[model samples]
Target chain A: MSFTTPTIDWAAFAPIIIVLGAGAAGILVEAFVKTPATRRTVQLALSLAALVASLGVIIAQWAALDGAGTVVMSGMATVDRQALAWMAILLVFGLLSMLLFASRDGGGAFTELGATAPGSVEEKLARRAGLQLTEVYPLALFAVGGMMLFTCVTDLVFLFVALEVFSLPLYLLVALARRRRYLSHEAALKYFILGAFSSAIYLFGVALVYGATTVTDVNMIGTAIVNLADADPLLLAGAVMIIVGFMFKIGAVPFHSWVPDAYQGAPTAVTAFMGAATKAAATAALVRVMFVAFAPLEWELSWLVWAVAIASMVYGTVVALVQTDIKRMLAYSGVAHAGFILVAFAGLEGEALTALPFYLLAYGLATIGAFAVVSQVRERAEDGGVGAEAVRLGQWAGLGKRSPLLAGSMALFLLSFAGIPMTAGFIGKFEAFSAAIAGGAWPLVLIAVLASAVAAFFYVRLIVLMFFTDAPEGAEETIAIEDGALTRVVIYVTAAAVLVLGILPSGVLNLFADASVLLVSVGG
Target chain B: MNPMNYVILAAILFSIGAAAVLLRRNAIVAFMGVELMLNAANLALVAFSRIHGELDGQIMAFFVMVVAAAEVVVGLAIIIAVFRARQTISLDEPAELKG
Candidate 1:
């Protein structure tokens, strides 16, 4: 082997560069800007600008994704189109979340039924009375940027850094809620500890892989392992360990214990961020490892992953069926969804790999929209104030009779979760299951379909609660909000996506096929 | 120098860490155990890097250490906050948010 100087594609890395600049700018704005409110505005604007730039880069790359666009950075990282696309999606998700958090109580019901038109003196006065905090935008963007980088990271070091870059801010995100501070605090603690443990396991796996194969560049490690497969015990141990760590992050059953508490306790906004983006990052990283690096040993590892997939599916769906609190139920549903997504990776077949990214997008959008709605609906207590507790199904008993639109949207999301035909979940589950079947994984595919049915029961139950079940006595029937434009937009767009993708999944499926399947013929 | 020895030591250390994560109740203790596992991994990585005469793995190990350090600070701070909130660090007792 000869030593060579590394080359970088700065243009390809434009999104990341822009985000880092925004993060720096955010810190500056935070320090110099006097009011937290004013600083939040500037910081959020900067973050949104960074996300917009990320979107632009993604579009540019999508226009030119014919070849594997590798911007090798000192032989450490690459700026590829697949990663850029995932990042672009992440930034857009971040932007939408920021929009929801941007408005002053626009989501809270005090801001809802309490005011008239903005031009009215009453509305203006109410606005002047309270200062809303929306500083989560910059932190969210930095986290999004880190996740974007996480998807594209070609080297081991970049991978770990990207993981932490996103993880740290997320801990704070959990603790930011106003109503359920204790729950948030506990959730943050559990999440932080579990996350740290998983990170450690991941690093340990990397170390063993390094020790056995004596290489760290994933491409190099894969090659060395292929040659040493019969001789290297360390490589085998390391591979299995790394897979376990990733399985935990993606909430594969048995390692999924923290998800429900974390999701339920964290603010709904933060839950959406973790529910969607974390899965994307974990799935992307796993694909890069499984398909790109260790594609050779697919036959052996596929079984382990398949077992996990089946377990996750059954566990998530069955547990969700019995949950009363909406958030905890959604958490279980997220777990089951992770299983469905992982089922797409039960083998190294090209079709299966393609389904992986598409499944993430479908699941991300659905979970994000669901959380957005959860954040929107408010219930007023006896003292005459509204908050998140108003989001319960009991309070939502007469929702259809009150605000038919919100009820209908909630119904669509529920139907989507059930993978009903004409929803994105349907398409996502179909493609993932079909991919697994194509890979000759019939039994696991059957189990996945069965688990979907189980999940459907809970999803349908929610629909019944929204449409058929009568409101409990003393419960609020109307959905009140302080601000809700962004939530409504997210709800409708995600619902429409579910329907469109369900009705005609072929287009997105084809796009997924065209996208790099995280399989880059490494040893060639 | 026996490579098997290095690999064995890493494995033993990792198992100890895993046991700690599973058996310990204190969040901070579990965190420390996780750190030990991480260090064991770093040791294996460097050892393997030296054996292979490769700089790539060594470089990667450096990055892993940086991430591990960051995770510790943030993780410890979060644990401290929770302790203050609930006056307990035992994972078994923090069912206040459980489903």
Candidate 2:
């Protein structure tokens, strides 16, 4: 038998290609580049340029697309407006995060040598030599590329591959924090094991799905379901398992044990990247799986979605209320945000299609911006030098008095998180709640509203501490504010985006509305 | 031989693997559990492919194997790094970050 070759649409696939290509080139640079300082500069420039170029290509493709979208690579992937929108959002996040990664004013975020033991002589020597872990740029690119692919791939096996491709890099990145080396290592180990375990479960689900339907292409599976007289037990089990895996990535409850540990343990810059981009990508993939592949099972799966969404909101908000550490608080807050995003899935209606993307965009911006602010607030050493990050809740007291701009930005992000009016979070929550209402999932929306009100208490408490509370006696000199140039730019961009999207959301809302169409493979 | 039997055997193995991951404290053993889970999925895939008369399941099994191997590399590296830092690989030992 002769094999026929499937043609690829190179232009349509250019954005993913550019980012992954840049990642491969970066590895070569790591091998060839001699000087650490020069290598850092080259890697930063390369990563930023690649992300910007990919963004441009996506915009161009968006303008050129006429129909729903085309299935390329013999139906292994689809390039639709929905996927393009998610790709653009992820690229913007990558651009901002890359800037954060390159910021070195406060001794940077990643360790000089990942292999060296913390506080050991070799670690000190590496630091003294001015060495830096510049490989993060490439790893981030690989992750961005994988996440982009994750949004668009059509086949279940390809989806599994994309999930791992993005996850592996992030697992490694979590371990490279300059401070709290042991904590970072523990986080990586836990994240790696749990992530692998979830993927295995997801793969078994995929296999069972294939076994039940004799097909792996998502659209084909949907077609098979339509033809079948009854839903096969294997198919249902597999679908649930598949979604469970995605839930772990999204950090939803029952599968969310890793979220806080990983978020708090990772370097602030890497956390910012993962917090923003990973959720957006995973949510995008979930929307696809739920909407395109498993829409027929909506009746059966709605309860699962509702249960997880409510659990995440209640559990996340309650735990976040008591977190003494800023990073850990944000991690629980992320879990709550995951629930909010899932709220759009309640009705499985068209409005949710627009609502989810907008919600993720708003949430991602606030998360990245907030974390950037966290990275800038450092601990003051005995000799008056900046040390590791000041993560305690009390350390932030009277921050507004010392640096109004930083504190104002932090306050803005916190308000956005609370879904207060005149911020992106407000519009995001409104759209999501309205979407759920339209889907006839009003009860879920009611619980979500209650959760939001409770979540706001802690968010506002932090605001009060920053603005109104006085620094405790003899603690006035404990917090040092470092003006890292790159971090400042990230904060400005994200905060501004948050406001613009909040106030004049019509432009983005309209764009998301137009891009909500998912293209199923007709060939399959 | 019924190919369905193979699928049932795969399911049993998957449960054992899951049990090991949840119950075991040693990092290496937990990792082994994950690998076993993956291999069991491969068995199910091949068995299903045999029953269905399609190459897609077999091809997917190959892809899973390659990805699983890559996972082994990364997982071992992370476990090694943790060991070097703390002189132990017990999952219960790292209590620094409260789950």
Candidate 3:
């Protein structure tokens, strides 16, 4: 038999191509560019340019789209408005994260040498030589590209590939934090083990699903379900396992053990990037899977969503209340927000399509901006030099008196996280809850509303510490705020976005509504 | 022997791998368990591909093998880093960050 190669639509794939291509080129730059300073500048410029160009291409694709979307790569992926919207969000996060990564002279967050033992002679030498792990720029691009693919891939196997493409880079990046090397390494190890285990489970699930359906394409799985007289146990089991894997990535409960550790242990810049973009990518994929592949199984599968959503909301909010560490608290808060996003999936209504993306955008902005604020506040070392991040809750006391701008922005982000009116988080929560209500999941929405109130307590407590309380005696000189220009840009942009989206959400809400439709390919 | 038996064997092996991952403390052993689980999935894929007279599952198995190899490189690099820092690769060794 003669085999013919499938034709590729190059333009449709250009966005992912551009980012991953830049990532590949970055490896060459790392080798050839002799000077560390010059290499960093080149890598930073390359990463930013690639992210911006990809964003441009996605917008062009959005405007020029003729129909719902086309199945590109011979059914390996789809490029619908839904995928385009997610891609745009991921790109924006990528751009902001690249800026954060480049801030503080490209060496603020990451270690001087990843392979060197912390506090060892080699580490000291690397630091003195001004070596930066500028390779983080390339790795971030790969992750962005992988996340973009994760949102759009049509086949289950391709989805698995996309999952790894993004996750591997994150695993490496999580370990490169400059401070708390032991915690960073531990977090990386745990993340890698759990992440790899989950993906293996997901792959097995894909295999079983392929066996039952005789196809791997998600839309084709739906068609296969329609044709079958009864639901196969294999298909049911496989679908649940696949979702379990997605939940692991989304940092929901029972599978969320790694969330706090990784978030706290990772460099704040990496945490900001992962917290925002990873959730958007995983949520987008889950939405596609639920709407397209598992629509027929909704009645059977939704209880799982309900159970996880409730657990994440209750557990996340409760645990976050007592946490003293800023990063750990935010990590738990992220778990609760994950629950809020899942509430939209309750009724499986079309409205969830719009609600989920908007919620993620709002939540992501607040997350990145808040983390940027965290990155700015440093602990004062013994000799009066700037030390590692000041992460304890008490350390933030009287921040408003010292750095009013940073403190004010931090308060705004916390208010937004608490879903107070006049911020994006408020609008995001309203949309999500309304979508759940429309889907006949009012009970879940009620629980979610209560969780939001409880969550507000912790968020507001942080605000009180920042603005209302005074620094304890002899602690006045403990906190040092770094004036990183790039980080300030991120904070300003995300804060402005949070306020604008909250006040004038109509345009964005309409945009999300219009782009909510998923492209369903048939017959493989 | 029936071809379906291969699928059964794969499932049993997957269970064993999962159990090892959850119970074992040694980082390398747990990592080995992950590799076992991946290969078990590959076994099932190849078996299913044969049963269906289709090439998709076999092609997928090849992709899984490649991805798994890449995973090994990263995983071992991380494991080595942890070992170098802490002098042991026990999963329970590091407890610096706690709630």
RMSD values, in order shown: 5.3, 0.9, 1.1
Q: After superposition, how far is residue A388 of candidate 1 from its true place, in Å?
A: 3.2
Give candidate 3's error at residue A154 in angstroms: 0.6
- Grade the docking of candidate 2: high
TM-score of 1: 0.91
Per-residue CA lDDT of model 1 for A201-288, tens digit only, reads: 7777777776676555667666776787384666666777777777777888888988998998887878888888888888887887
Clashing pairs in 2: none
- The interface RMSD values of the models, given in order, are 8.0, 0.9, 1.0
* Per-residue alpha-carbon lDDT of candidate 2 for residues A478-501, written as tens digits (9 for 90 to 100): 878999989999999898999999
lDDT of 3 by residue, A53-76 (tens): 999999899889988876787568
- Sort candidate 3 into its docking category: medium
Q: After superposition, how far is residue A469 of candidate 2 from its true place, in Å?
A: 0.3
| Cα deviation of A503, candidate 1, in Å | 3.3
Worst 10 residues of 3 chain A by lDDT: A99-108
After superposition, candidate 3 runs with Cα above 4 Å error: A105-107
Error of 3 at A482 (Å): 0.9
Query: Candidate 3 at residue A6, lDDT?
Result: 75
- Residue A411 shift from truth in candidate 1, angstroms: 1.4
lDDT of 2 at A224: 85
